[model samples]
Target: MAGPGGRMMAGGGPGQRSIDFKGSSKRLIARFRPERATICALLACVVLSVGLSVIGPKILGRATDLVFAGIVGRDMPEGATKEQVLESMRERGDGEVADMLRGTDFTPGEGIDFTAVGDVLLFALGVFLVAGLLMAVATRLVNRAVNHTMFRMREDVQTKLSRLPLSYFDKRQRGEVLSRATNDIDNIGQTLQQSMGQLINSLLTIIGVLAMMFYVSWILALVALVTVPLSFVVATRVGKRSQPHFVQQWRSTGTLNAHIEEMYTGHTLVKVFGRQEESAKRFAEENEALYEAGFKAQFNSGVMQPLMFFVSNLNYVLVAVVGGLRVASGSLSIGDVQAFIQYSRQFSMPLTQVASMANLVQSGVASAERVFELLDAEEQEADASPAERPDEPRGRVALERVSFRYDPEKPLIEDLSLAVEPGHTVAIVGPTGAGKTTLVNLLMRFYEVSGGRITLDGVDIARMSRDELRSGIGMVLQDTWLFGGTIAENIAYGAAREVTREEIEEAARAAHADRFIRTLPDGYDTVIDDDGSGVSAGEKQLITIARAFLSDPVILVLDEATSSVDTRTEVLIQKAMAQLAHGRTSFVIAHRLSTIRDADTILVMENGSIVEQGAHTELLAADGAYARLYKAQFAQAVAEVD
Candidate 1:
């Protein structure tokens, strides 16, 4: 697996079957120590197999020439030297040589003992057997290490996704990122495991065979070399053409997966809106695009193998014609001609394997580039300084002309100033998109202010470590998230001190959640699904409130905490809030006027500035922006009563 900064972790799955390592050469090298034992074993196997195999072919050619020379009475014609003769005989079929020297020369039925041939054949067979065993073991070992690395890569990518600044997800698509981590990595794995294994073995065989051919007939080897480069050129051209198509294929796949995920998540919405047909049509468009891209990529890459074989076959014909002539003219032995045929196939096989793996290499490279891009992402900055420890519970927070925006050019909070004294409940009232949430966000250190500073007890929030600053305050948002766990676990989330069952129950009762808890089959022990999706929104909200109460922080922030419930629940929540906010400084954000009526100060905000600020009655007396809002809510309350 590739780590942050493009370094591969020690363990990864086997090399990709398709593209091999592609862009991760450094990662592969970093983990080379684990692979070293396997590589050494594989190299040993290849050396033994190739050396023995090459020698045997040459040995058989010499044996044939020697027997023919004896028949023609011309001292073997000296076509090959004594060393070449021995090698040619060693290269032939192990069983044939064994049969020829089955009995001693002293035995009556023995066929003119070729015992040296038997000895060489036995050695070659032993080498072949050992090589085969070692190669298999090496392949398995490499695969295990590679698989581990791939698993780490997936894990690292997931951790990055979670820790990345929230802003990163705003611009990137979920499905595209998922594709990079999952499907792309799997493709790389498959290519490494199967094709890469074959490629290595085939490559070694080809090189060994080529060397032997050079010794046999340099001219014929040159002719074969010409065809080798041509095959590579063709494979390269085809791969270059196929690469864009493969990338498009994966891109389309991501789009299709995104739509599918969306549809599944919003099935109820789709059904209610009667948009199934339209959804299917969109899906079809994406699916068709994927098919076209896939066909183009696979089709082009698929043709490369056969093209290489075709080129190899042409070279084979030329070699056979040229070699046969040399043999007939008494310049080459019949055994030499036979050996050339075997070497031709050997040289061609590696090229064919490479051609077949070319597309895999390209695809892996494409996927690797995407993976590296994500791993290279800039992490959200965290304060490196040690957390500051305040002497006393000042609980005072002040925004000194604090201004901020999600985008730098577009200001959300413009020269906004607010102050909350220790033990004061400050209610922030604003129309939609009036930087109400933005103010709280700054206090939470979720986003940095474009200008000005927010201070906790006179210390800039930014100067204090984010965790420490958040630790001093508790927030209950409009949407509550509860992990899949028991109710007790949920309530204890942000608590600084250890919470007992009694404390948890006390918090729940204060939030009016204890009433519903007794009705549950398992009560506080009931397991919640992901995000508390199984629970009602009102109940989830009350649970979140209980959580805040349990935390018992010096500073509190309630952002529409009771807005999603019934009137009765709202009343109960108000009582709980009154209790929870008794001593601690609080910041309440709400659209409901009644919730904040008892607040020490109410700030009516419009645009990015406060339009009105005073006590409820004082604002009503002013007959300004607060007065207009109060009148509207009062009228609605009267109409509901009627």
Candidate 2:
């Protein structure tokens, strides 16, 4: 079964697929190993900030005590000692007031002490100010750490792509792969940035607030924790339900992206075929699937916050009731109860905050899973050390009993052998899927042969690094590829070393592309997109041929190199290829029987084997597969002319 972001596994949707929460979380954290130093600094700042914040409420509690004491103390006789005033209240049947008064340290003759209170308030303010400053620093560190981690991840992804075999891409959509590299990685970064620092702060605040609560009054502390189990239940239940949806959401995102990319790239074909409505219907279906998955994921996770808030409010009532009782019973001061109330809030808030962020954390982890899957995919076999070089570049290429298959049960090419001597041009003529392209692929090492081996200059090609082997060969296929650059730069891309402007122009002239290039507004300097937007199909074909010419390869392989060009241009390209083929080995795969009559060898391939091979004249005289194909093309041409 193909996994997420490749193709959906058959018979399994999001609900049927469960994620390893602990495993994904651990792996995601492991990606941050390079940023550990920055993380340590961030943690230190958070710890200090939370420590000071937890202390702030306690300091304010002291000021609260002073004011309460002043009010009570002012009602007592001015001349009396503090003990006598409390005794007087007890005797007068104001026993509850006396009990509450016992917990405060107040002078009977005094009122509010503004100066002392101001000092306490100022110290609390300073602590909070420092805490905020430290948190700000921590946030900056968070950004730094996350950005660095993301940068490395992108680099890793790019490197992995280069190392992967072509088959990996063949089995997957370009947009899906791109979504994992771009959207998924970006999501992971945003998730970490949004949650990491805040999670740390919330947790530290919880711990610090718990300690302060215990210090203030154990009874009230126990009261504030009464609903903690309930909060945990709500969080886990909602989180569990939402987790699958998050996975599905990302999966759907990749699928939708793949559909959109496929459609956009083939939009011209769709319009030509009048399939616009059908395409829209398919797009709508994918979009709705994404919306459904996203909506369910969000709605399920969204339930956590309100449920957590309910638990917190319940805890609040318990603390308030128990705290008031403690104050009335003289077991705790009013100011202590007030501070305990703030501590209860501090304790509940992190739990609530974490619960609310369930969706973000879940979403990020889902993206992390996707990215890790890409990274973990089996890469192509490592390139070997270069084989011992031949005495010189002779380009004598041979394949002995090469076998290959895209699927194990279906053999596409089996036990194939071919040899081309140095300085010879070999033309391969075959119907579609007859392994003409597959043969060249094996030669280029795009796909390794399943059995036996291929050799260049008497050295096993597999023993050499892929780059080392392919660097000596030049390829121009019917489907040309050009990057977004000027015509000069695009052509120059073929050369392994820097080339002079004269050399570039000469190569273009050789390919018959120089005339058209010179007519453009900027000549060879005119820029084009990767799709070669400014050039016609045949013009693009000519530029690619020019590119191949610039490479000046030791071995040239052309697969329908002139398929896009007009008859006049095809003749010109053929002349250029013939000149380039001098003193080097050349392999041409073509369907046009007329173009390759002068080749030193003509190979007729069918069903992955060479059915007939010789000079074109000899094959025609033999009246075999090559002659039959040639006669068929001749008849088609005569019919068209008539």
Q: Identify the candidate with maximal TM-score.
A: 2
lDDT of 2 by residue, 387-407 (tens): 555567789999899899989
Poorest 10 consecutive residues of model 1 by lDDT? 101-110
Cα lDDT, model 1, residue 107? 25
True-structure lDDT of candidate 2: 0.90
lDDT top scorer: 2
lDDT of each: 0.76, 0.90
Per-residue accuracy of model 1 over 391-464 as CA lDDT, tens digit each: 68669989899887788787778888888899899999878998888788888877778899988888877778
What is candidate 2's CA lDDT for residue 313?
Answer: 89
Question: What TM value does model 1 have?
Answer: 0.81
